[model samples]
Target: MNEAIKSVKLADMPDYELVKSGTGGCAGCPSPMGLRIVGKALGPNSIMVMTPSCAVASIGVMPKSCYDVPVLNVCFASAGASAAGVSMSLDAQLKSGELTGEKPTVFTWVGDGGTYDIGFQGISAAAERNDDFIHFCYNNEAYSNTGVQRSGATPKYATTTTTPAGKSAQKKNVPLLMLEQRVAYVATASLAYPQDFYRKVMKAKSIKGFKYIELHAPCGPGWKFASSDTVTLGRLAVKSGAWLLWEGEHGKLTLNTPTKPLAEGKMPLTELEDYLKAQGRFSHVMKSPQKDAVIDEMKAEIRREMDFMLGREKL
Candidate 1:
């Protein structure tokens, strides 16, 4: 219920650690703690245009980098056309003044097989040309760095390595498909709410155009779990209404951080059957015998997607 909800305080972010402590992800990989808190809220000016999964195979490779800024790898369906050509060639080298200071915030650290399948038409044509930058997507769902397979943000009965037994279509709510493309900003976030993912990456870097978020990175070995339960299974998937922190901006909807105590019911979902019995990709839908009708159809599709994101938070 975002009646203008902006509250971040891990002592108000920005002490810049631009993701560098031994970053090659895997042991409890929440994508290297969601790329070290989104590269410390996009500081060190910021470039990060990645692709080919797991944010460029777990933070930089050769010459042993782990990002202090300037990442740029590209191509898994061209991460929204290489972050819209690095935000229009750094806005034409700062309007022909030949690139000065400030204004280096281009983004795109895709994965979920490059944002819900082959870089979803280059971030839906860079959100129909509103493309200035910021397009995150960490989404540890599937095709996790090219081995776990089954991705269109894989969900439904879980399991993967090309849906070994589950994933019968259901999980692509790419921030309500980027708020149905009216995109000025859209959000979901979840490395289990580190200050609501640092106040939504400092409010999507104080917005511009085509900004998207979609965080939720929790694939400790592709959901087999217990790499210290990846931030307690991303806080039991937002206290078990199954990941629905919200935000839409420009096109309206709100409901941020823990989704307003799970939309005013005061967080009563009590972690979905012990968070789907602690992962193992839903442990073959919890050892099916039609495991209580597939956990009551995943608790009625998490109460019909938390009542379709609290009925789009009124406007």
Candidate 2:
């Protein structure tokens, strides 16, 4: 039943609530926003595969789920492989007329620690083979569920359990990597803009082959920010040009609104300082001798990313 979808406006958001309330999560959690909208967009005919991540903790143990859809918990590095197997099995049964129901959509819900590092091997293999599944990487920028340790997606100068002083390396560009792999769809979404993410998820549900969507999850406890300030922090991250909003299908890229002008250089990136300062993770950098240097480096990286994504610069 998947096909070209009409644009889903904020007001047009469906009432189907696949993810229920009273689920476990830190106060002011951002992943729930994604879970809710993604559920609505995918509707009820979907099976979700999960790895070790915040959702595992929030949604609780098996048979104790608040989710309305079928969920399979897989090993940390096997979400891609596991979901692919399930999809293929469903297809086989459907073709034989042995399974009855709407064609089930298979997808994975994972975190940055899984996607950018350990699970990349399996995820990449699945992508290379064009697996019929969707992988959602909810990046809080660290292994927030496990002592706030650093991960490949951790931004520079952020203090994590493993990188107390600061991190030296830049974040791995997973979406760009997916684009290079020539997947069917690659997109970046943020919690502050549910409408953008909702539409993208709905569109990806209709597309064949691998689909990857990385959500910019705002971490409160992990980032040392209040839960209530999560949404504002996400908006600040975008205004500062730290995070981007975009989608690409079959190599045709379209920069979404809000971020379009920023990438086009029509709007100045003026909120980087506020964005970084709002989270305590970067407090050490802000008070250090290299404060200006650190921020300058971050700005430079953001510009470089935007320019590269816009095809104005070579990688």
- Write down the lDDT of every candidate, Cα atoms only: 0.79, 0.87
The candidate that wins on TM-score is: 2
lDDT by residue (tens digit), candidate 2, 107-204: 99999999999899999999999999999999899998988999999998899999988898988989878877879998999888888788889889
**lDDT value, candidate 2, whole model:** 0.87
Q: Runs in model 2 with CA error above 4 Å?
A: 1-6, 312-315
Which candidate wins on lDDT? 2
> Cα deviation of 6 in candidate 1 (Å)?
31
Report clash pairs, candidate 2.
24-58
* Least accurate 10 contiguous residues by lDDT in model 1: 1-10
Over all chains combined, what TM-score does candidate 2 have?
0.95
Tens digits of per-residue lDDT, candidate 1, 1-315, equal 233547667677667787777677778887667767876777788888887766567665688777788777867888898888888888898999899878978887777778888879889888889888888888888887767888777888888877788888888787887787768888888887777777777777877878888888888788887788888888888887777787777678777655677757875767587988888888877787888888888888888777777776765
